[model samples]
Target: MSPLPRFGRIADGPPAPAGGGESFATLLAAGGARVERIASLAQADPPGAWYDQPGDEFVLLLQGAARLGFAGGEERALAPGDWVVIPAGCRHRVAWTDPARETLWLAVHLPPIAGRGAIADQ
Candidate 1:
């Protein structure tokens, strides 16, 4: 058959896993970058928790809405078509997500870009 159709709906997936823990599925990986589909069902970082990733991450909010809190004490709200980049070594957390709807996200992870600053800082 021809190359597998690289196609599917972003929101296509079984209902968010029970317990509402955010679910992440990698869709592609190549060289030094990868893509994923993340679904968050009314979830937020655990009490006082944060993420300190080893690589940079760029995420686009495709459905519902979300709030991202950075270690620098700033919280950014994201809506459909909105995107943000978290530079490697940056500390951040999911502050909130629309609990009444399914929050769908397309996320890309890549090796740190030399001398790049957190997109939220600009």
Candidate 2:
């Protein structure tokens, strides 16, 4: 026997939050990897806060703009079609997001592979 197929569009999913909020919806989870659709509006990490995850995260900006800040003081700006890879245990935060528009993101979380230093693109 074989697994069945699944299909859906990112645009036809849930709407982003209104009045400055955020939402995360899981699209798929299998073999220790998870994919999600994140929607945000005028949202960011609080001051002096950072995210230290157990797995690597690959994030793609589908709509609007955002800025990511690292613990080492580096920052990266993202626009539509931009993407980034954040490794496990890397302290980072969402520094800024477009205040006037809804920002949609696709995030894939990958568990660390044994004997691998960096998470390669899949």
Candidate 3:
């Protein structure tokens, strides 16, 4: 197997909505793995943006704290160094973030599960 490459710098990604108070940077993308950097708000508030994708996602908090809102009314608070796994196609949004500090998140998008139905199912 090839050795993993080292990441020295983070690249800027798509711009978040105005007043949304969020930002992201893509770090890596390989055959079945991807890594990104995300920043956002610090308090529970609705009207935030949601993200859903065909592949599963894993997030590791690098700085600050925030809460994740799921489609099923489930909410999870995460702090720096915390990690979370989100199954493919699970509708989710940010519920809160540290207002004083920008929440930095390391997100990894993995390949979709094989033989699994579309993400809309579960």
Candidate 4:
């Protein structure tokens, strides 16, 4: 087995959103794993977009708060230190961000699952 590589602090820039306002920063990208730091508007209410990925995403809130709007019309509030697991192929988007402060998030994307099974189980 190959040894895991070590990385220091990673600085990310804004994400380019297809919509009017959205941005993100990519912190780490190696093989099937990717970590990103995101910052965005605090009062923007955007519709949930239909998007899919091959890998599952794990998001952790580092600062501020926001709401996630799922494709099924479900909304969930996320605060600092809050974490959520987003399954692959789930359509979602950021519905709201706290206007009081910048929303910081740590998102990790893992390799895609194979054979219609969970990636973690493999």
Over 4 Å off, model 2? 114-122
- My TM-score estimates for the predictions, one after another, are 0.83, 0.88, 0.72, 0.73
Give the Cα lDDT of each candidate: 0.83, 0.88, 0.74, 0.73
The better-scoring model by TM-score among 3 and 4 is 4
Give candidate 3's error at residue 49 in angstroms: 5.3
Question: TM-score of predicted model 1?
Answer: 0.83
lDDT of 4 by residue, 48-101 (tens): 455566778999987778888887789899988899888887777788877656
Better of 1 and 2 by TM-score: 2
Worst window of 10 by summed lDDT in candidate 1: 112-121
In model 1, pairs of residues that clash are none
lDDT of 3 by residue, 1-122 (tens): 99996656432444444455777666777797788877675444466557778788878887788888988788898887899878887889888887776677788888887887344433
Worst lDDT 10-window in candidate 4: 10-19
Model 3 vs truth, CA RMSD: 5.0
- Per-residue error for 91 in candidate 3, Å, reads 1.7
Per-residue lDDT tens digits for candidate 2, residues 16-121, read 6787767888999989999999888888889789998878999999999999999989989999999999988889998988889988999999987777656666
**Over the full model, what C-alpha lDDT does candidate 1 score relative to the true structure?**
0.83
Best by lDDT, which number? 2
The model with the greater TM-score, 1 or 3, is 1
